[model samples]
Target: MTDMNNPDNGGHGEWPQQQRPQYPRQPQYPQQPQAPQGYPQHAQYPPRQPGQQQPPYGYPVDDAAATTVLPPVPAFDDADATTLLPPVPPLGDAETTALLPPVVPGAVPGAPPAAPRHRQPVQPPFQQPAQQPVQPVGHPQGYPQAPLPEGQPEGRPRARARHAAPAPQPAEVFDPPTMTLKRPPAPGPAGPVGAPPVPPFAAVPAQPAPPAPPAAPRGRTGSPIIEPGLQPALITAGAAALLAGGAALGQVALALVVALLQLLTAAGWFRLNGMWPARQGILLAALAGFTADAAVLLADSDGGVAAVVGTLGGFFLLVLVLQTFRPSDPKERFYALTVLGSATVVTALCTTLLVADWVPAGVGAVALATVLAAAPLPGPKQLGPVLGLVAAVALGLLVGAPVALGALAGLGALVGRRVAAYDWPSRFVHMTAGVALPLAVAAPLIWMATDLLA
Candidate 1:
């Protein structure tokens, strides 16, 4: 019966020729008591004998009657032997959730799914032994391979090569989870390309040294240091003596010596410890020397004006030298220059009298008067008085030539105190050069104008 139902068996109810057993058919009855002739024994079974029954396995009368009464089987074709199976149900939410990708929080829904990841497929769930955990092949005995969870399908290929290294990140960037990619080295020999060369340190020029500080103030000690006033007093006395003696020869010799000393001191080559004395004394001596020389040269002659002008020129030169070489104390320096200027005026007046034979009484008075007018201004406190003197002199000079000579002589002294505060050399150069130049041009003009006798 099982062989007849199997689709692989022959359909004609015949067993395979090679597999069939050869059996002899046994007659159930001796010809089945010979069916009544022509009545067709196929329609009726023979009557059974007492104590004898039908055969144990054979077509029966009841089965034949039951088949005749029942409805006909549906063609009894190949289709009747096949069974109908139930269809598979769709997946549930939990299964679907496991299969679907997790959504990023802010991403739009209903968007087309992202492109499939090209990675090696994940391993499928394995059929594990009921009580034993599956162990990885070639791994330690206790280290089991992590099995795919239940509810997954089989035969999924491994995801594509997602493990390939990522792109290299910049060094400055702070990567909490470090990137694993090994970047290719930047193109060539790692030398800086198109960059400015490192400048040779030797090419840089050295810086210049800073200037030294100016010299300290003269005669001024922060600690109240004592200084001798004798030099200044002696200087005043010597100037007084030269003016009073009036000896032409003695004056000329003294003045020449003083001029030489002054030049030496101004050059800084000599240090005469006479304090202000040497400078003041030198000025007085120079005045006397110039006066005496002019006197001898101009006596009994028309050259008295020349001698006077030349003496003035010498005095201007001396003032210029003093101004060019500044003293630490501007006040004292200008005071000394003022004394020299005044002496020059005195000598000029005296020349008019003694050398040119101008009347002594008048020239003496003029000389005395000019000397009184032209003196170094006393101090900062005396500025008002000195300025008054200056105005008075200017006023007098504009009125007469005699006063003009005195005004010129006194001019340097009066203003020198103010200008002395400046860089002495530069100021002195400017003033002396300005005055000397104009006078140089004017001297000849004045001589020509005055020389009516010539």
Candidate 2:
């Protein structure tokens, strides 16, 4: 092969330029001949003459124009040019110029000029009349008058009065009469001098002492040891325990119970946070709980915990995204996120019982704790929680659950009871959230305990 890289090679030489192809020009056609000269021609107008006028071509010649005569055009001259325009009036002082009306151009030569505008005489500013002084009407004759204050005029009195004080009067002295005491003889069963004789002293009748003031009705010294709504709370706790115990029957039945519990939790949480009428937030939290439950159920036994965690994380992100679309103030949005996040977490916690095998033991401990705490035992306020924990441990022993699990569940129950009592919870809150929250709160503890002990 020839050296392809060499500039001297024939392949590297410049190639000839290609010429552009041309086509033949179009053929020309012959022009037609002009019309014959014999055709009739249009009539021509005559040329205009100096100092002469003519009507325009195509203008009709009426009898008026033909019969009437027009004056001949004047010859151009300096004198005649000066007379063409009217004379201009000389400028005057500003006052006269302003008073005169403007001269309008193109007015009739002899027509009267517009009447001149005259200046109106100015009037002086208004002056208020001097006010006359009012005379005093009720002056007593020879009465001394108060001296006028400086700057006040002689005839005019001050707007305010300063009255002269009245003269002092003479005082009179008073004398009292004197009295003398007379001596009486030594005491005999008789009256003193100039008095009637007295009778012997008689025994006085005894009078009953006033009945003692009705004893002040005693009021309660302190708050009750057990908070109000304990009975309803106890009943609610019992119901939650019964539902949790249903796990032995079937997972579906237990799941249905848990779902109901989560629904109540969502609703109660919104109301507790004063966010009622927030139907969307309630439904979203409930859905998150249901999803977590379903995920726990569908997942393998060992993957149950992982399934719940994943579902919770996904719904958390969903809550964040949904919050962005809410048409609320920034503060309201933040508050909603706080309420919604807490509600979702609380609802999701219910899934722990479903995954854990010791659901009955834990729920039983919680119920027992609530029952003992609600009982009106005679003791200090702290006695309730102590007794509740004791009962829980004993119940756990009987049920063969760990003592730690029992104590934890009982503690959770006490805490949930306190929450129910907080902010003066109503009977409705006690029945719903109060009933379910103990078991819900203890579920995770139970799960962890069971896992550790196993």
Report the C-alpha lDDT of model 1 over 1-454, residue by residue, as the tens digit.
3355554342335556677655456768655475677675344444544444343334455776446545567665433443353323333333334444332222233458656544444443333233232222233343333343476543332222333212222122222233222222222222343333332224546679899899888873353312112232233223323432443445444334334323322222101111333455445434544564555454546565666666667666866586558755888777655655543443333333233211211222222322332234466645643554465355434545344343432343223222222232332233322112212222222223223312
Per-prediction backbone clash count: 9, 0
Per-prediction CA RMSD (Å):
34.7, 38.4
Instruction: Identify the runs in model 1 with alpha carbons over 4 angstroms from their true place.
Output: 1-241, 244-299, 307-409, 416-421, 424-454
Highest-TM-score candidate:
2
Query: Among all windows of ten consecutive residues in candidate 2, which has the lowest summed lDDT?
Result: 173-182
Q: Report clash pairs, candidate 2.
A: none
lDDT of 2 by residue, 224-259 (tens): 333535676567565656666678787888899889
Off by over 4 Å in 2: 1-228
Each model's lDDT: 0.37, 0.69
Q: Positional deviation of 320 in candidate 2, in angstroms?
A: 1.4
C-alpha RMSD in Å of predicted model 2 compared with the true structure: 38.4
What CA RMSD would candidate 1 show?
A: 34.7
